[model samples]
Target: MIPSLGYAVLLIIGSFVLNLVVSKIRFNRKYKFPNVVPGWPIIGNMLDVPYPAGMWGVDMAKKYGEMFTLNIGGRRLVYLNSSRVVTELLEKRAAIYSSRPYRPMMSEIMSGGARIVLMGYTDKWRNQRKIMHSILNGKQSEKKFDDELLNFILGYTGTLGEYQFNPLKSPADVFTWLSRLPKPLQWWRPFGEKFCETHVAMFQKEYNILLDKMNKGIAKPCFAVDVLHGAAKKEFEISDVEKIYTWTSLIEAGSDTTRVAVLQMIAGAACYPGWARKARDLIDEVCGQNAERLPNLADRSRLPYISAVVKETLRWRPFLQSGVPHTLTQDDEYEGYKFPAGTEFSWNAYSIALNDKEYSDPLRFEPERFMNDDLKLPAKGHCRRICVGLNVGANNIWIAAACILYCFDIEQDPEHPIDQFNTLWEEPTKPPFKVRFTPRSQAHIDLIEREGNIALATDY
Candidate 1:
């Protein structure tokens, strides 16, 4: 009977707490934004946000205007939806905006504080920024023949076997510069090849070769090579573990990201045929009928609309579903809310991108929305370790998009109607990579040779 009394008392207390949370959530009846009340101890309605984060920002902004506080595991996270507010906190107050939030797990297993992308504002960060600035800033990024080499290596080496199995009549079937490989891994399927095996094998071989040459001091300095060399020559005084960490960070800060950007551009073209056609028409006007001479960096001004389309593609489907979670190194105040230092925060860009106030006809796939100078959107930079690879990313997208626009007539399969397309709310996680770029015409061959060949003339 005594134990029963104790259990009943505890149950009563738990019920009372649950009721209190529910009331607080619905306390202000007029306001609402997917806010969920808390459950038992230490747990809030964290799972309420939509998955793949589709309409993520728009929904939140609609429910909670300029500012809304989220209770995540007892830590309060404030989401700033207004552009002006964001500019104020993340840009104007550079002193406060620059410090990075702690990422214990990633810091432990991965880069710690070496790479520019995730590193915080610190002495080491300043050093990384200095090196990064030298490596990637301003006109210096015009590292003549450097990107051209990477483009070809990515083209020739990355997709060689696939071309062999699925032979291409295109003139691009010419370069052969790869390193060694495992005996069994190099073998291809007699029929439909397991492409990943070949991709891994060949890529591993070439990457190893590049690594070996880099280590031997015999090869021309690639991006990674040059940066790491800077680190060494500068006597970074880092551990061997950190060297491996640096290399891994460099790869993360570079590779797959650029690839994904291009892939999204392709996927968007395929899904929205009208936009692609519009871009192609613009390209034809400036670049001429012969799709053979791909647009270079020089053509950006002449073909502003094409540039608009590229920007639209990025805006439509950003790769990451959310802004990387940001942690505060120092406490700050916003409005009247006192947010302590070491707090975690993030803006749901997906939600912001689709927000009605920020964009008109937000759901419509219209590049024209960004046509006028009055309303255009480039990634507004932040002080807290802002994106370091903007030029690399932009150049890659511009060049790749220019190439695709010049040569391909991307169209959705009529058999697979619009309804059949995946109506995902959030971008899928590690989504299976699938795409199709139908070659437009024979002239595309000439263009590849004209632009690609010149760039690839002497291994970049």
Candidate 2:
């Protein structure tokens, strides 16, 4: 009886203290704007969230309207839906609003602020952005990379898409697969996923040696050239050590995102057979099924369906589900909900892009859905800070798409439709290998083999 009484007394005291603490965390009208939403104790209303799934955010948005306040893990969350609110924060009021709510784990482990994606608006952020723009901006990426194109043709090109993918492969087989990757990917052959620590180790060695080669004119400068040559302007006034960190960030962003995009392309091609055929037909008309050279940017207009395929690929599986999350810089209130400063708000790109209301048939792989007039581009501020490599990414994707169609017909043969597109996401079609691109005929095989037979000149 004494023990029971003691427990009861403690519980009352604890409740009192919790109430006091909650009361102390003020959300007052004097400082904050019109606050609308309610938060629960401790975990807040955010405890209701269903996680590990991207659709939850959109469902919440519809329920709570475009803007709402949520409390998760003792922090306030302000969700901005629709185009207007996002624009107000990111673009119109850009400076005060652009800070990322750095996660405890990502900040601690990530190297040298090697995360420009998480960078708040600051001078260092400016430097990093400046450097990126200089290297890949406007005509430079095309001109510089194009100049090196011929050499790679006579040599080999490396791209992110695996020549082939399937479940359960040996590590040795993976490397061999990489070495003999098809076409444009062969051009980018040396680059591979850094998920393999060994791959990164090898990459670091190759990078240094390649830099030396560029200096000696033994090879050409792509990314390294602009950075080393100091074309990055005023923002790049830093030591070589600092530059390495910046370069590392650039490499991480550029490589991983594009790889995911390319993977999505392969998956979509198999699932959307009609789109695939249209793409091939366009390729046939433009390249004549026996073109001397691979498709480049100049050939894009002649091939509309193939271009659509590439565009749809980007929209289908954007590289990131969420951008680096943001934290409110000040205690702001709106719509009768007080959003305390330092609240976490991450933009959900996946949810926004695949929205049923926004997209006609969100689940289906229909490229024509994009051809709709209003749905042509993303709503404003929705994807604030557009992809820096937009043109290059597009160019590379289109050219590669055309080249592949010209040389091969991608379809699932002797396999059920279920094998091509994994709907439930468990086992997920062995990541893109559920679909395959068989060479259309012997002539197609001969041409690809003939063009792809060129020796890779590894100066290093």
Candidate 3:
């Protein structure tokens, strides 16, 4: 009887091994593509992919050419290292390439499928996207908040990296069935639950506060007020819960990205003071040398050089190296290459932006590269899934950069030399580096104080 039991266990193990071999064979036959990166069997390329995939992708592109594929735990991903292919697959074929990749940890477990960025292309996602567009599609109002905002941003970065880059490092990430185990046994479940609770409470509190202010007829004309009571609320069909997450999602999308962009702008000025001087000269020509007024959105069209600086900063150092992943909804072919449905894809922002084919002398911080282009830098993204808040974020960065350049002469602090390439895995995206921000002139100092008092009075 004991021998019979042992034989039964051996048979179970053999069947499982057989199934795995068959699945691996099918996976290989199904995804016969070019420039496939070498990876392990069954596990595929999870261990091979690294952090800051942007740089790694650039290196891979140099070796493998423009398009390459990496299979991570049976799931294949195609990385577009050139803007040409990105435009072809993501833009020209937007109907199928607009959906997000499967992220069991980020989308379902942590966000409960409510995070707009990670949501799949579905009717609910469409409705939520509409709500986000209507509310956050305009110029952002300047509002101040405390450091608590950092917690959410940092938490999101950690959570996003889990599934965005090399997913399936944890088996449970791919085989979500493990999530069904008893809560006590599931080690990852509690953290996700806690994060969701805190995230919802923090945003919902702000939502409730805005609702109260609206009831008192004193709510400001902002995204929240617009969505809660303005005509947009009536136009879109979304629950109060969806409404709350939608606006917060905009904050999640914009806040940290805008911060990193402004920092990079300052870093650019420090590294290349000549361009900063040029930008200030242009600002002075438009706004006035005696600080008659601060640069505003109206002056944007006239300040082409400043606009160029903004573009150069982003191109030189893209904030999210791996622009969010997109998934194919159906089988498709591109240039004689077949992509099966459920194939995940992403653009190596670092690679595309710095490719010698796209930008000459790519390492240099030269705003002149964009000077001849249109002054008005519009944020018309690839396709249907175009960044809803990109325009607003860009404008915010533009104004902030204009104001900084107008008010101060940024210099690299000799005590602590700035490394523009230095970055952290956590929030603030760029690590804190000291830079000297000396006021350009006495007039600039006076202008700063005057504007400060005016904004303070307006807030009160």
Candidate 4:
């Protein structure tokens, strides 16, 4: 009887091993990909894919060249590590690469697939993107959140370096199966739910107020106004919950990412005083030291150095480190490797932005690299799925950096020198550091106060 039991156990083990081998073989046969990293049986690179994928992705790119594949629990992820590859796939082949990957935990369960950022390439996503574009693209975007309003909001909210909703964490957590656990068992689940609920409530409240203002024929020209008007005209059908998510997602994108860029600029200024001096000198030359006013959008063209600073800040430490992942809708091939349909592609922005081939001394925070040409900012993403708030975000960073540099000289505090490198992992913030913000002159201080008062009084 004991012999028979032992034989039964052995047979069961043998069958499991056979299943794993068969599964792996089937996957390989279906998807003829390149630089495939072998993973554990059945799971397929689940354990191999690192946490904080952006940092890991950079190392992988160096080792595996521009493109590589990782199988995470049967899901195929293709990492595009070079600007050429990202532009080729995400931009050039946008039709097939614009869809978002399916995430049951964050999208369906946590967010009800209502978040615009997480929505797949569908009619809903297209319509939502259209609404966002109308509000935040082209010349219209400049009016929506002008420099003054943006500065006021940023200061009022004190959102800089504050931990808002982290979109990156959800994807990694779900991919690792942690988000699949029961709420009671998952520590982050409860907080995530609460955060979503709070935002939903805020959006609902704001939507109702905006709708009422629209009824009164006194609504402001904003995302909420556009969405509400569209629904009234039957341009699209969106539920209250979906609308809430859409508007909130826009706010999250516009606000949090820009805030991070500005903070990084400040950190850069403190770390490299010489560059900061150059920026200040440029701002003074353009805006005029005795102009008795802070720099605004009108002066943007004249301040090329400020633009370069903004570009460098974005490239140096992109807020969305990996950019948004795009899922392929059809099977595609690049450089002789076949990528199966449903394969999700992530642009390793960290790798591409810091590519030594693209930028000399890639790690150095040099604004001069972007001075001569219109270098693509991966922080805004790429292709048909590029960020709708690109123009607004750029303008915000440019004006904010100009104003800050014009008003004060930022230097590292003698008491608390910050470890800037270690702070890169903070999602959108540098480590806590004290910086001396000495006014360039009393005239500068007076100018800032006068302009700030005007900004506060003016409503967007």
Best by TM-score: 3
**Order of candidates by lDDT, top first?**
3, 4, 1, 2
Question: Number of clashing pairs, model 2?
Answer: 18
* Of 1 and 2, the candidate ranking higher by lDDT: 1
Off by over 4 Å in 4: 1-20, 38-54, 146-194, 373-385, 414-418, 425-432, 457-460
- What is the lDDT of every predicted structure here? 0.55, 0.54, 0.74, 0.71
Counting clashing residue pairs in each candidate, in order, gives 10, 18, 0, 0
Give the better candidate number (1 or 3) by lDDT. 3
Residue by residue across 219-281, what tens digits does model 1's lDDT show? 675565665576669656544334433444444445545666666677677766788888888
Q: What is the C-alpha RMSD of each candidate to the true structure, in Å?
A: 12.2, 11.0, 3.4, 4.7
Model 4 vs. true fold: TM: 0.82
lDDT of predicted model 1: 0.55
RMSD of 2: 11.0
- Pick out the ten consecutive residues of candidate 2 with the lowest summed lDDT: 159-168
Check candidate 4 and list the clashing pairs.
none
The candidate scoring highest on lDDT is 3
Higher-TM-score candidate among 3 and 4?
Answer: 3
| Per-residue C-alpha lDDT of model 3 across residues 1-460, encoded as one tens digit per residue | 9999999999999999999899979966765665888988777888877776767767888988888888777777888888788888888888899898666666776777888888888887998777667666544433322232445665566555655555644456655567678878887777777777877787787777777777888766666666665435377777766777776776666777777778878888888889999999999999999899999878877988877887787787787777777889999888878788998888877777778888898877788887764545544221123577767777778899999999998999998887655453234444567789898789889999999898767731
**Tens-place lDDT digits, model 2, residues 168-286:** 12222222244354545553322223222333353456557757787678766566556666734643575554455455544544444555566667667766677778777767776
